[model samples]
Target: MPRFVFIGLLLLVSYSGMPQDKNVSQGRSTTSPHMAWEDLLQEHVQEDGRVDYKGFLRDKQRLDSYLETLALQPPKEQWSTQARMAYYINLYNAGTVALILENYPVNSIRDIDRPWVKKRIQVGAERLSLGDIEHKILRKMGDARIHFAINCASISCPKLPAYAFTESGIESQLNQAARGFINDPQRNTISPKQAEVSKIFKWFRSDFKAEGGSLVDYLNRFLDEPVSKGSQVKFLPYDWALNDILP
Candidate 1:
C-alpha cells in the first residue's frame, strides 16, 4: 500500500478503538446500552410491586450510579418515540426511588413536602421535578399507556415493573402494564354494569379520554369483563400509603 493510504488506515483503526460516548449514537436507535436500574429493581421490588426499602437502602450506591448515568445522558429529539418513552418512564421511576431513599422511613410519599413538585432530578443540563417528567414530558407524548408505566411510589399508583423498560420491547411492555393495572382487582373493579377504578382514571381523565369515547371504552381495552358504555363509574379513594414490603 502507498504510504499515505497506510497512514489513513492506521488513523481509522485508532479512532475505532477509542471508547464511544454513551450519549452519542450513530444511528436512529437511541437507548441506553446497559441498564443498571434493572438489577436494582429485580433485587428490591417484589413480584406484587411491593418495594423492599431496606434492601434498596443497602444498594444505594448502585442506584446512585445508575441515576448519575441517566442524568448525564438526557433524551434527544432525534431519538425514536419508543426510545424517548422508555427513557422518561425509567427516569421517572428511578427518580421516585431516589427521592424515597432520600427520605426513607416515611409512611407515604405524601409525607414529603411537595414531593412531585420538588425539582431534585438532574437530567443533562436541565433540573426537573417528578411532575415535570410525568405531566410536561411523558403525558405530552400523546400515549395514554404511559399512565400505567410511571409509578408514584404509592399503593394506588401502578405497580413498578421488576425489569427496566427497553426501546425494543416498549410496546409490548406498555400493553402488559396497562392490562395488569386495569385488571388488578385491588386497583380496579370492572363488570358489565358498573365499574370502580383507581383515582388515576379520575385525576387524569383527559389522558384516558384523549383518544375519544368514555373512560369505560379505555378500560375495556385491557379489562377481562367489559363495562357497559353507560355504566356508572366511581373513582376509588387513592391510597397514599407507601408500597413497602413488610417482614
Candidate 2:
C-alpha cells in the first residue's frame, strides 16, 4: 500500500476507536422510575382512593425499589416545569406511603413524632421528609393546585387519584383534583348561606389567593352553588385518622 494511503487508513481507525460518553452521545432522556410507584398505588389503593396499608406492606420490596430510584434519580433541573412538578408530586405521595408503611398498623400519620418534618427517607440526592418536598419544593414552585395532588395518608387530606400524575397530564390532573376537592361535599361543605371548606384552604390560604384570589373567590370559581358574598367562612376540623381501606 502507498505510504499516504496507509497513513489515512491508520487515522480513520484511530478516530473510530475514540470513546464517547454514553450519556452524552446517545442524548437519552431520563426514564422516570415513578411508574413503579404509580403501579403499586393503583394496585393497592381502592377505587374510592383510600389506601390499603396492609397490601402495601406485603409489597415492601416493590416500594423500596421505587424509593431507591427516587433517591438516586430525581428529576434534573433542565427538565420542563411540568416534568419537575410531576416528579416532586409523585415523590411526595410515594414518600408518604413509605412513611406510613414504616409504622404500619398505626392509627394516624401524626402518631409519629413530627412525621412530616422528620428527615429520614432519601430522595433527590438528599434525605428529605414529606414536609421538605411539600413546603420547601412544591410550595415554592408556586402552584396552589398542588395541595389537592399531594396526599398525607390522612382522612382530611385530598384524595389520592387512581392514576398517577404525569408530565403530559399534570395540568388536567391538577385541575381535576382542585375541582374534586373543592366540590366534594364531604370535604368542603360549600353553602350559599354559610361556606364551610377543608382545613387545607385555611392552611394554605395564601396559595389559593395566589392561584385565583381570596378563598371565597377561589371557591366560587369551582363551586356550582357559589358561596354568596359575605358568607360565613368556617374551616372544618382536620381528621387525622389513617385514610386506609380494609380488605
Quantify all predictions' global Cα lDDT against the true fold. 0.85, 0.79
Q: Model 2, range 41-61, lDDT digits (tens) per residue?
A: 778988767998888999999
Q: What local lDDT does model 1 show for residue 41?
A: 88
TM-score between model 2 and native: 0.84
| Candidate 2: C-alpha lDDT | 0.79
Off by over 4 Å in 2: 1-32
Q: Residue 130: error of model 2 in Å?
A: 1.0
Provide the global lDDT of candidate 1 against the true structure: 0.85
Clashing pairs in 2: none
Q: Which candidate is the best by lDDT?
A: 1
Kindly report which residue pairs in candidate 1 clash with one another. none
